[model samples]
Structures are given as C-alpha cells and as structure tokens.
Target: MREEGKSIDEAINIAGETRFLPVVLTSITAICGLIPIAMNPNPQIAPLAIVLIGGLISSTILSRIVTPVMYKLIPPQMDEKI
Candidate 1:
C-alpha cells in the first residue's frame, strides 16, 4: 500500500478492512476444528487444544486492535534513493 502511493492511515485502513474477514474466518474455522479436540475426554490433548483455542482468540483480537495502533505510533523509516 505504501508502495502504491497510499498514505499510511489510508493504507492501514484499507489493509485492515481487507484482512478482517479472512482473519476472522480463519480463526473461526480453526476454533471450530479444535472444538472436537477440546471436547474430547483425553486429558492431555484436550487441555492442549483448549489452550491453543484461547491463544488463537486472544491473538486474533489483539492483532486487529494493537497492530494498527502500533503502526500509527511508530512511523515507518523510508529510504529515499537519489
């Protein structure tokens, strides 16, 4: 987006909008896939699956919110060629 001459804010908004659906759908799919594992009676695998699901939920939410804020707070370092 930066390479396409979009301003940083515009680029971020566009990227975020485009990515929201895929990110959410992927997470939802993974969560659905893991539900059976999490529900299994096997103690070892069930705990692991539950933890993984939790991590995925947290990461998906955080990335959607924090990444854009961080990008805005920290300006990119662009190199200009003469």
Candidate 2:
C-alpha cells in the first residue's frame, strides 16, 4: 500500500475489509465452542473456553477501535517495506 502511495489510514481500512470474513468465521467458531462448554460443565475444559471467548470478544472490540488509530499514530518505517 505504501508502495502504491496509499496512506496508513486508507491501508488500514482496506486491510480490515479484506480480513473481515476470516474474523467473522473465527468469532462464530469461538461462540460455537463456547456453547458446548456452557451446556455441559467441565471444570478443566471450561476455563480455556472462557478465556478464549473473553479474549476473542475483547480483542475484537479493542482492535476495531485501536488498530486504525495505532496505524495512524505509528507511520510505517521506510526500511520496513515488504
């Protein structure tokens, strides 16, 4: 994107759109995993499910808020071009 002369913000927006489907799929998978654990209580297996669900939920929310801002704040280093 930098090579194409796109700004970081534009790149971030485009990248997010491109990556949206994979995110949705994973979110659904996480929720599906959560359901089985919720239905039958297993002390050991449940914690991992809870942690994954919590992380997935919070990170999805936070990243949607943070990623673009972070991209804007930290401009790409010229030496970091792929």
For each candidate, the alpha-carbon lDDT, in order, equals 0.94, 0.79
> For candidate 2, which ten residues in a row score worst on lDDT?
73-82
Per-residue CA lDDT of model 1 for 1-82, tens digit only, reads: 8877889999899989999999999999999999999999998899999999999999999989999999989968777768
The list of candidate 1 runs beyond 4 A from truth reads: none
lDDT of 1 at 29: 97
Alpha-carbon shift of residue 64 in model 1 (angstroms): 0.4
What does candidate 2's lDDT look like per residue over 1-82, in tens digits? 8768887778888988887778878887888878778556778887887788888888877777787788788877866546
TM-scores for all predictions: 0.89, 0.75
- In candidate 2, clashing pairs total 0
| lDDT score for residue 52 of model 1 | 91
For candidate 1, report its TM-score: 0.89
By summed lDDT, which 10 consecutive residues of candidate 1 come out lowest? 73-82
